[model samples]
Target: MTRAAVALIYRRTDNSGTQLLFIQRARREGDPWSGDMAFPGGRMQPEDASPRATAERETLEETGLDLGRHGRFRARLSDLITRHHSRWRPMVVTPYLYEWKGPKAVTLNHEVEHLVWVPLDFLAAEENQGRRPWRTPLGTLNMPCCRYQDYCIWGLSYSMVQELLAQGLP
Candidate 1:
């Protein structure tokens, strides 16, 4: 019934090249994506003007990093296909891509148990490639995944990363 937005903040280092930010969710029971690796974001609020604002707000709330203070806000990517949760109705997720030029330590909130900076080149590596079986209301489906460090970034997050890398990377 409603839509959400997510921010995919990435950094380009002179030596290491591009790196994407991934946050490890806290081990909370009854959460669909519990203890999984994900980007910084959540559902849009009524006060937010647009999905972009929702993304910025959620990123700040989850990661404690201010895009306005650290990096320049870049272009917003096209909206991904709408995903529906069992409890909630169908919702569209619009993902935004922001590039941080300078380097700074990341501070994650309690909602995030750990944080990782994954190299872009390793996204499709052997160790990162995996599969996840999901039984949604639509039906049973097998989803491809990329696990980096200790977090398994699969499903919509993985799909978003794949699309962003394909369309936004230079």
Candidate 2:
């Protein structure tokens, strides 16, 4: 069966421009997606009332940011699914989006190794587009990606950003 997940998209405005929060997962031998840059989210729990609730809960668990208290949440963006080599059995994953209110620095849990607040304008730039050969245990091939300094946003994470772009930028 396909598993369900949700992510909280936190964005904020500054004199420079709007930025989005991204978390880098800590590398663990057992994690299929270890060390990947991703949004704050995870699989839905039985206790979660809805996809949005799952997103809110995971955001708090991963970043110590409570969307209900310190932030405003909008159920914007559409769901995205990807088949991944997860620890779980054969599955497709659904990711729902909840955008947080403002630019708040994050306090990450052990599950995260780093945090990146990517500028929206950087994502919209054509110069940032490129392809690179990425090797995973599964194999290697050139793939579409966006580079920002030491980070490369690709795979399903790239898909989500594409959706965000398609929705039109401010």
Candidate 3:
């Protein structure tokens, strides 16, 4: 089965410049991306009218922020397809960009393990660039990663950040 998923790439601006919200997924045994840092989102549900709605809905459910009420929908960003094919189900994800003025507080739901506000400038720093070890059935290999303090942002989360940067937002 092919699934459609959506994510919200939320940015906040103030006197301190801009920062993005990233969440660490809670550890779950069967989840492929468990404990990974990612934008708040998930598979599309029946009630979601479109991919945007899916993003908005998931954002609310995961972060307790009603994007419809709190965020200014900017523009739709890039859509990413699953690079590694799965024998079971595959997914395509569309990300929506939303900007919030001033500062915002996040109240994470159970689906999230932790939340980190990633400073835009930190991402551009050369020191933040590193590699993370990814273990597969074959062996462990180092994958490109961005580190902030103790949190390591890599894989799809890193790719999404690249897309957002490519749009000339920061």
Q: How many clashing residue pairs appear in each of the predictions shown?
A: 0, 0, 0
Task: Select the stronger candidate by lDDT from 1 and 2.
Answer: 1
Which pairs of residues have clashing backbones in candidate 2?
Answer: none
lDDT of each: 0.80, 0.73, 0.77
* Residue lDDT tens for model 2, 37-101: 88887777789887668777888889887776766655456556555565435544455544566
Model 3, range 1-170, lDDT digits (tens) per residue? 34455554556455666788888999888777888888888778778898888888888889877778878888777777773333545567787778754236777888999988888888867888899999888999999889987788998778878777767774
For candidate 3, list the clashing residue pairs, or say none: none
**Candidate scoring better on lDDT of 2 and 3:** 3
**Poorly placed runs, candidate 1 (over 4 Å):** 82-86, 135-140, 168-170
Residue 134 displacement in candidate 3 (angstroms): 0.9
